[model samples]
Each structure stands twice: as structure tokens, then as C-alpha cells.
Target: MEIRQLEYFVAVAEEGSFTRAAERVHVAQPGVSAQIRRLERELGHDLLDRSGRAVTVTAVGAAVLPLARAALGSVESARRTVEEMAGLVRGAVRVGMVVSCGVMDVPELLAAFHTSFPGVEITLTEANSDELVSSLVDGRLDLALIGYAGPAPDGLAVRVLADEPLVVAVTDADPWRARESVPLDELLERGVICLPPGTGLRGALDEACGTRRPRIAFEVSAPPMVITLARRGLGPAVLAASMVPPDLHAVRITDPVPSGALAFAWRAEGPHSPAARALIGLAENRVTAP
Candidate 1:
């Protein structure tokens, strides 16, 4: 039997419905049935027991199911291998970055990648670290520059670009500006402008808080806004040590100081698109922390 017929048979066996199998294989239901009949004729045996409401595979069908799946998998693997050999010549890469990502120069990296693989189309999206990780898991993103706190995400290949302490920033007019460091309890006592929850920065802050809850004055997605509002004397801002403005007084968090980590990540398992593989290789070769 032809690969198409085998494919249809496998789909039917797995889906247990000719209509659903036809939809999955993008063929008409009648066509799928005809093909399966032809396959059964060639094999000289009935592959499925369709007398019941739910289709069941016959003994011979069960025996051939794994082989059919293996054949399809082999073909797919071969296609991916060839595509990867072509590098980023003809494919799209969906990339993600955390909002206000300043740990590494993402634009510069993208520019370099484009220069090298001019044929590859690149798309960029911005979101929180947690959202980015979720997108990666769901196959919506090919790669991401995400901020993570605590442990790295499960089933993701992570290359850390930056890991630094979280600091509290205040204006010169603030009473605690002269202090060398601030405790988590003391920092939470004042109005704090920080990154919203569901972000790596927020995770770190929350971990540091432990049982205590901080009064968040303003929850912003943009990192620069945190410093801007604090500098305006609105409230104290919590941000990465490196993100703290040069003019603002940055106080280290003394008790259980939280730290934010920025990383480049992709799916640890599964086949990567050609452009995704190329970009990942390029990033690995030329990752310099800012």
C-alpha cells in the first residue's frame, strides 16, 4: 500500500472515526474510507472492525500500527534534517522577549542574525517572563529572552545571560536614600512601585517577602517606568541592580535578597524549525552579557 493509504489507516485507527481521521489528514471522509479499503484489499485482510459505534483496530491493524507510525516519523525526521542543513534559508522564527529587557542587547543580536541569514523572516513579541515561558511550552515561540527567578522552567533549555541582585531605588529626597541597604520588611512598609506579578522580577520579590506582603503602589510592565516613578518621588522602586539608574540611590536588600536571572531559552525536546535552530546556534556562539 502507498504511504498515503498507510497514513490514512493510521489516522483512522488512532482517531477511531473516519470523519475525524479525514479531518486530521485533510482528506474527504469518503476518500479516507476508499483508501483504507484499497489498503485492506492489498493486504488481503480487514484492518478495522467498524461494525461498532467506536472503531477498533483488528489484530493485523494493531500489528501494523507501530510500523506505520515509525514510517511517518522517519519521513518527518528526514524532512527536518534537510531543512536544518539549509540553515535559515527559508523559514520563520518567532522570538519573544521580556518587557523592558535590558540584560542583553536583543536588537543587536537580531540584527546580527538577520545579517547572517538574510532569507529568514523574524518576528518578535513582548511579554512577561512567565507568559513567554508559557508561549514556548505551547509552541507559540521559537526562542525567548526571558527573566526567571528561583529554578529554571521544566523542559526548557536555558542559557543564562544575566543573574544579579534585586535592589531598591529611591530619590535623594527620600529618607532612606542615605541608607546602604534596606530590609525587605522596611522596604515593604513604604509605597513600592515594582514589576507586576507573573514576572520573574515579581517572583523574586515575592520569594524575598516570604509571609509578608508588600504594598505595591504601582504595578508596571516596563522596567524603566519603575525607576522613573521612584525618581519622581512617587515611591520606592524595586528593580535589578543593573537596571537601577546611575543617579538614583540603590539600596541592597539585606534579608533574603532576591535576584533576577535573564536567560535565552527554547524547547528542550521536539524538532526546532530551521530558522530557530540557526538563531539558537548564532546566539550560543555570540552571547555577551550587557
Candidate 2:
């Protein structure tokens, strides 16, 4: 029968009372009963046993109930799909970034997207690269600016934005300032202030050190804090070269300089909301910009 008739039939089957089903579907009891009767006639079966005080589904009705529900669900899903396509850039896009993003201009990129699609809401979050990658993988984040020590995280589509050497920061008073670069071992000898584990920089550092545990003086998330500590001579701060303060001497890691790779990543083969797609397009445009 018709979709409306099927809706009435399903409501009656679920509610077990014509009056209650009518109320649930916001239709008059007589109208609901008439529709169900029409549906039964069309299907050529006694769909409901209405002889008793409470209505009950017949054998045929029982078999048809699940199919009817599936039909309704499919219709609703199709309606939503059409609505989403029509309302481009209407939903929210959750974007993540590392604590210190030196490669991509997040604000500039977001501003451009917002300007193009004012209807789209851009929600920004800052976390370490590892955490950002995890969020993206779990669908908590639609897109992200993540840092990687080597290749990008698996199961994600990545566009490398920038690649730069990791450096050790020190104040002018520090003896290491005289040298242009220092070996990783020498830098770690005094004390190393680094981002905590589960971060891109720390991952790179861990990979480089390889079996040799460096003395970690302090673990902080903010790159500026690393510079602050290094300036105070608390320890040499391991940081992305771009993040090093201008006043601080940035010593390149000589023995196998660990490079920080920044990239834009998103789910490889998942359904991306219109807003998410719009933002991704903007990011791609930014990547190609001179």
C-alpha cells in the first residue's frame, strides 16, 4: 500500500490500540483504522486481529512489521541525504590541530572557509599531533593539522604542508649557542625539556634516541613554554625549528636531524559531511597557494 498506510499499520502494530496508535501518529482514530483496513485489503490479509480489547498482529502482520520499519527508515535516510546535499556547508565541522602549528596558517585557512560558507560552523581544537590523529581516526575530528615523525598515520589521506628539522633551543648565555648544531646525544646530556609522550615531536625524538633514554627535565605541551624554560637554562628545549623563538639559538640536531612533518589529514573512505568537505577543499586550495 501507500507509505502513509504502512505508517499507520506499523503504528497500530506497535501501540496495540487503534486510539493510542492514532494519537501516536497524530491522526484521528477513525482515519488510522480506515488506513490500516485499506492496507490489509491491498495486501489481501487480515493484518491485525481487532476482535479483542487490545489489538494484536496476525502472522502476516508480524512478518511484515520489520520490512515496514526498514522501508520507513530507508525513506528517512534518503530524505536526510537529499537535505544534506541541498544544504551544502550547513552542519558543523570539527577540526583539530597540534598545540603548536608552525606549518599551516590555521586561522587564515579557517577565516577563508568561514567567509565562503558562513552557514558552516567551524569548531577548532588543539591537541598534540598523536592525540589529533587518534581523534581523526575515531571520527571525533573531521579534519586535522597533524605532525608526524615519519610517514603519516595509516588509514588517513594526508597532504604534506611543511617539513622542517627539529632543533634544540638555548639562550645566548648557553655554551651550545656558539655552535650552529649539536648532536642529539650532546643535547640530551645536560637535560632535555620536551613535549610529553604521544606527541609528534616526542615521537621523533624517541625514534632518534633509539634505546638510549634521554634525561627529560620537564614535559610541557606549549612550545613557547619550552623556549621559556630553555631561556632560563632549565634545559635544552627540543622543538620544531619553526617554533623556536627568534631570540633563542636554534641548534640543528646534527646526528640524524629528526624532521617534523606537518600535514592535513582526514578519513580516507568515510562519508564526509558537506561542511567537512567544504573545509577540506579550502585546505587543499591553501596548500596550492603560492
Measured by lDDT, the strongest candidate is 1
Off by over 4 Å in 1: 1-82, 288-290
TM accuracy, model 2: 0.69
Report residue 220 deviation for candidate 2 (angstroms). Answer: 1.0
Q: Taking the tens digit of each residue's C-alpha lDDT, what string does model 2 give over 159-183?
A: 8887778888888888888889898
Model 2, residue 226: distance off in Å is 0.6
lDDT of each: 0.88, 0.86
Runs off by more than 4 Å, candidate 2: 1-85, 288-290
lDDT of 1 by residue, 33-99 (tens): 9999999999999999999999989999999899999999898899878867676688789999988
